[model samples]
Target: MRSAFLIAPLLMMLSACAGEPTRMGASTKLVEAEEAILMPPPGSFSVAGITQKRFSNGLQQEIFLSTTSAVPGQNVVQMRLYGTRNDLRYRDDHLRFRTVTEAGIDAEMRGTLPGIPMKRSPYLVQNDYGAFGYAFGRPSPTELCMYAWQQLRTPEGEKPPFAGFGAVQIRVRICETGASERKLLAFMYGYSIIGAVDDMRWNPYGPPGPVSDRLGHSGNPIYPPEMTAGAEPDAARPVAVARPARRAVQPVAEPVPTALPGAERVVVPSPVRASSAAQPAANVAPASSAGGTIVPSPACVGANAATAAACP
Candidate 1:
């Protein structure tokens, strides 16, 4: 009985390390735990929109876009529910540097989570954090991870596969204006821990788990300040450019020719021939060949016509 009692506490400790804390909906418990240490986001910002995506493995990804009075663009924060396959190959730190450098992040900060191992990618550079490319153990109710990445000083147009890590990640970019490195880091820390906790609480596996009645509410939806103005917001949206129309073709006319100057005029008459009636009239009587004697015609009108001078 004593052995079983000791085993129970040991099992619970391991489970808590592997699972979400007792207060599922919030990361406060995690922060309270030594594993996480960060201040929560103050009333300065609120969630503007939530984009939720369900993957092929029945896992969910949620992106929370928040608007702050101190930031220019809406902060893009994401969280991937559950985790990835265990057998996937994790790239070396040298490869990780090469990858994110190619994607535009020039500098990186490396560290580990309290309970996770040192051999894995638990590091969060400038603005990147979350399940950093490795999966935690499965079936433990609260085991969730997230990541964030941003290329602040670098110019746009870096070939993707951004030099960061994670199998499933949530990225919250650092705002351009009205944002300091501290706030950006705070946001990264807040979301990587709390944002992931929020996602897991909202869409948990199997039976509905315990939720914080207080933190579960994601406040009222809001839009960016630029959109709240009374003008059309098409400038933010993409538009298609129309192509030009083609012109119709007109046909050419042929020219008429006149006779050339100084050319000789030639007249060619058509040949004429006597008809059958005229032939019979001219040869009314047949004449003897080389002799003055008259010859009779087979179709003679009168027998006297056949004789020479006496018949005519």
Candidate 2:
């Protein structure tokens, strides 16, 4: 009977062990697309999916997938935003992958990210949000990839609102086929943080700084070079003035003399001026030939003659 009881307990223990669920140490939940904090413009990138995870230690992670595919397989463009009440230590240890940490450490030590069996270079990017350091690589002959990470927290000496801790860690991995670096970086520039924790102290972005004194003051009108002077605020864009087309000038043809039938053609040469020391020739008037053609005098052949002057 004792052996039977022991076997029953052993079987019960084995059944319990087999039925126990695996502990993931974290709770994962599917979140709505609208709940995402980092929102890429709908025109350029639409949210295809989103996953939200809450760690036991109070770290929140939200990952967004865009409609554009990063690689040939099922992978898509991914943007991960992590919010922690304290510092980024938790993320570095638990949230980030081992390879990503190694890449980051290599970047810190070597001034560049270590490529995963490929060549990669550091890419610098800045926008209205903040400046970010990224690593760029070409995964294939036609595809390009860029990875960037940024952490936002209150300044070291500055006190956060309500004496509360606030920090945000952002990670982006984007790839495109036959896309330029500028096109890939445009996502970094256009993404906006639309959601935040309800607490006032959980502000990833601090108070707005004061605007420049020169802005919106007298003699500080802001206008582009293409803007016309004295344009009204509600006026339509100025029309471009059309230039007149140039007229091409045509050449005039010289008149040619025609010879009478059965009459020989005569050739004429321009006369050259005689030396002043030579005696002047006697005047000889031009005579009309039998065919009523006026013939030039011999004296006039070698003398300077005006076009309208009578031959002499």
Candidate 3:
């Protein structure tokens, strides 16, 4: 019993190391734990929008978009945290980086996430804090680990091989501005900590147990921010995507060749295929193929006949 008590203090220190300290600590990550936890927008008063998707593992992922959506792919972010002190480690030993040797560590397709220009991808990560690659820039170390951790865990609540996760937690959040409300933000707030099996960058112990997805099912229904009662496109909102404009295919009318050079100006005939039923006289291009036989597209008919480059 005395030995267990002595070890407990060391473990608590380690757990708190990964915990969201609301104050930054010594880590190479761009955003420190303090910065990540107290970063203003997610504070008590403000609630941002949240978006979630379920993965094949039955884990649900809830994402929060910031007030102003930055151009996608342009902004990169990571959240590194440590879990409860109960896992076992030193009193001040913060959650270490996630090691590939650890269980549940896996790779995935970027999905909607933009491609990291192959020229710019740190193709390999050393742990939750650092990566190896030949890119123009690398994300701050701490974030890399946290990002990896966030990517590993989903909202549907994917369980790792471990029966219970030890200290340290990490996550990734993409910010957006145009959201009508903050359901996404609330989701992230609720996601971190709470006896959850957190991912570690590197694990010293051989094989941790499995994560029980069904453990502590208490995170209840989320209350989104107040938006209009109606006309909000209320069913799983669709994102607005921009489209390119269409270009005109035909050129302006020119003069037709005249037999008597200077005598009279002849108007060129307009291109037209199938004319209206009311105007059956419209010049419809005779059907034919481009290379093999003459075949006409609807576009080759009617007033568009003049530009029928496909006609024989």
Best by lDDT: 2
Q: Stretches of candidate 1 above 4 Å error?
A: 1-44, 58-62, 68-73, 82-101, 104-168, 192-312
Model 1, C-alpha of 60: deviation from truth (Å): 4.6
Model 2: lDDT to the true structure: 0.57
Which structure is stronger by TM-score: 1 or 3? Answer: 1
**Runs off by more than 4 Å, candidate 2:** 1-26, 56-59, 62-64, 67-124, 160-164, 215-219, 223-312
Ranking by TM-score: 2, 1, 3
Pitting candidate 2 against candidate 3, the one with the higher lDDT is 2
TM-score against native, each model: 0.25, 0.51, 0.21
Judge candidate 1 at residue 235 and give its lDDT: 60
In the range 1-312, model 1's lDDT, one tens digit per residue, is: 999999999999988867323433321111122222122266434555444433332223333344432422344453443322222123211211123442232122122123322122354443233222322211123322222443222223321234212223233433333444354445544533443232322222123237756554676345577676456667675678898988878777677787798655443222221112234345544433442433333333253433322222
lDDT for 207 in candidate 2 is 61
For each candidate in the order shown, give its overall lDDT on alpha carbons: 0.35, 0.57, 0.36
lDDT of 2 by residue, 111-170 (tens): 322343334444565777666666666756777766666666556566554743556667
Candidate 1 worst ten-residue window by lDDT? 28-37
